[model samples]
Target: MIGLTGSPYGSSFPYAREGSFYLSGYKGAAIWFAPVPLFDHSGVVSTFRQLELTKTKFGSIIKLHLLSLALLIVFSFIFYALIWKLAPIPSGAYPFVEKMWPLQATMETIWIKSTLPGGADVVGRLIRWEYISAGMVFTTLLYGGLMVLKAPPLLFYGLIAGLGTGAWIHYTLPTFIGAMLGKFYFSKKYGEKRWRAYAPVILAGYGCGLGLIGMAAVSLVLIAKSTSQILF
Candidate 1:
C-alpha cells in the first residue's frame, strides 16, 4: 500500500477510524435529519394531525406530559437536592474528547458501506428506533393486559410483550433467560452482594478486552505490511 499526504493517493477514509466506526453508522440515520428544540409542541401537533389523532386526545397527552414534567421538577428538587450534578465531560478529559468535535459535527460517511447492500438494514433499524417511546408504552400495556388475565407468573409477561415487539426477541430472550438463571442459580452460587459490587468492573474489563483485541489485530497487520518505510 502507498501512503501520501491528504490522501493524494486519490482516496481518504475518516469514518473507519477508532471510536468513529459505530458513530459512523449514525450518518445513515441522518438521511433527512432535522434538528429540533427539546420542547417542540408544534412538531408534535403536526405529527398528531397527520396521524389523525384528535386534538382533544393529543391535548390530553400534552397536558399529562407537562404535568409529569412539573412533578418531576418538583420531586427532583425535593428528593435529589442533595445530589450533585456535574458537566458531562470532566475537566481533565475534556482536552482529549474535544479533538473529535469536527468529526462529530460532520455527516459524510463516504461510501464506507457501499459494497454491502445490507447497510440499508442498518438505516431501517435506525429509522425504526424513532418508535422506541411508542414501543415502550405498547409493551407496558401488553404486559399489563397479560397480568389482568391472572397470568401464572408475572415475570413471563416480559417474554410475551418483548417477542410481540419487532425483532427484539433476540435481545429480550437472552436477558430474560440470563436474569432468571442469574437470580436463581448464579446468585446462589456466587454471593449476590459481591456480584452486584463487581458487575460494573466485570463489564469494564470485557469492554477493554474487546478494544485491546481489535488493536492487537490491527497492530499485527501493520507489522506484517511490507510497505515503503518512513524516515524520521
Candidate 2:
C-alpha cells in the first residue's frame, strides 16, 4: 500500500498509489496526481522519483519565483500610484505634499474606509478598491504625461491601456463600481445631493490623471523661468 503526505508547500503521494488529488486556493485550484505505473515495482519507484525531480528542478523553480516577483512589483507600483493620487496634495504654501507623497497616499487609503459602505467593516472591499483605484491612477498618469510631453502615440497607447483597464475592472468587478454608484445615487437622492460630495471622490480617483495636470503646470512654470533667464 502507498501513503500520502502533505508538506507545507504541497501534497505528495507514494509511487504505489496510481491516482490523483486536488488543490485549492484564493487564486484557483488544480489537480495533482501520480502517473500510471508503467512497469514492475522498481520501475514504478523510479518513475515517481523522476516525477518528483522534475517538479523540484532548480531552473523551473527559479523561473516561477522570478515571475511571481515581477508580478508583485507591478502590482505594488500600481497600488502606490493609486494611493498617491487619492491623497490630497499639500497646498503650495504648505510644502509637505512634495515631501510626504507616500504618506499622503497611505492616508488616502485609510480615508477610503470612511467613505466606503459599512465604513471599516468592509475590509476586503476597501482593499480591492485601493488596488483598482491605484491601477486607474497609474494608467491616467502615464497617458496624461505622454500627452503633455507631446508624445501623441505614447499618449494614445496610454489612454487605451488605462481606459481599458478601468473598463475591465468596472465590468468584471461590478460589486466595486456598484457600491460606488450606489453611494452616488443615495447621496444625490437623500444626502446633501450637491457637487461637493461627488467632487472629493472624483478628485481622489483622478490618480495619475490629476498628476499629469500637475506635471504640465510644473513644466510651464519651468519653461517660463528659463525664458526669463534667457531674456535677462
Candidate 3:
C-alpha cells in the first residue's frame, strides 16, 4: 500500500523500505530519486486519496480504498492458509519472518516481534490497527512545511538522525554516513562510474554479512539465556 500510494517503481530507498519484499538483497538494488515529491507533498495516501480529500475524485478513492482493503484481506487469508497447510507452527506461536522484515517501516505492515530464547511477545498481532497515523502525519506535515521553507534535505536528514539516535532508533543513519564516505573515498581514487558499478555489490554483500551477524546474535542470546538460567 505504501509503495502503491507513494511510488510504482520502488526505486528510492524510502520506496524500497516501503516495499522490502521486492528488493531482497541477493536479487538487486533500485535506488532512484523522483522529483515530484519535492514539489507535491502528497504524503502516503494514494493519488485517488489525494483526489478524494481535495474533492476531485471522491467515489473513485472510496472504491479503490475498499478494493485495496479487500485484496489485503484475501491475500492475508491465503497466506495464513498456506502456512497452516505447509509449515504449521505449534499452537499460539508464530513463525519468525526474519532477515529484511525488521528493515521495513512499521506502519507499512503488521509484524510479530519475538525475543529469541525467552520467546517474549514484544509486539503481539498487529503493531497498529488504525489507519490514523499520528507520527507519520506529523512528520509528513513537518517535512512538507520544511520543504516550503526551502529546507535542505540533508540538514533535516541529519537532524532526524540525531533525534532518532537519542530515541534509540539506530542502524540506518550510521550506514548511510559510512556509505557516503565510502562513495567519496572510492570515487575520488577511482572513477565515479567504477564506484557506482561496484557500490551495489559491496552493499549487497555487506547486507548478507549483517544477516549472518544477526544469526550470531540469536546464538549469543540463546547461550546467555541458557547460562543465566543455569547459574541463577
Query: Per model, how many backbone clashes are there?
Result: 0, 2, 0
- Give all TM-scores, in the order shown: 0.32, 0.17, 0.30
lDDT of 1 by residue, 87-199 (tens): 24424324555566546544333233422335533433444555867867876786577779877543343344445442366766786787787788867888898777776
> What lDDT does model 1 reach?
0.52
Candidates ranked by TM-score, best first?
Answer: 1, 3, 2
* Candidate 3: tens digits of C-alpha lDDT, residues 1-232: 1243222322223333323432232222222222223333445456656576788766776798899999999988975675555433542223354533454545222211232223333333324535337656866787788899997655455545444443344665676677688777888887889888888798799999999999898657545533523455
The lDDT ranking, best first, is 3, 1, 2
Off by over 4 Å in 3: 1-176, 223-232
* lDDT per residue (tens digit) for residues 1-232 in model 2: 1222111111122222211211111121112122444443533565557658778675775697799999999988975675445445454532566668778666545444433445562334434667768867986787677868888553354345334533466543764565576577756675755655775577577876889999898657545533533454
Which 10-residue span in candidate 2 carries the lowest summed lDDT?
Answer: 21-30
Relative to the true structure, candidate 3 reaches a TM of 0.30
TM-score preference between candidates 2 and 3, better one: 3
Question: Which one wins on TM-score?
Answer: 1
Global CA lDDT of candidate 2, please? 0.51
- Alpha-carbon error at 134 in model 2, in Å? 50
Q: Which candidate, 1 or 2, has the higher TM-score?
A: 1
Q: Global lDDT of each model?
A: 0.52, 0.51, 0.53
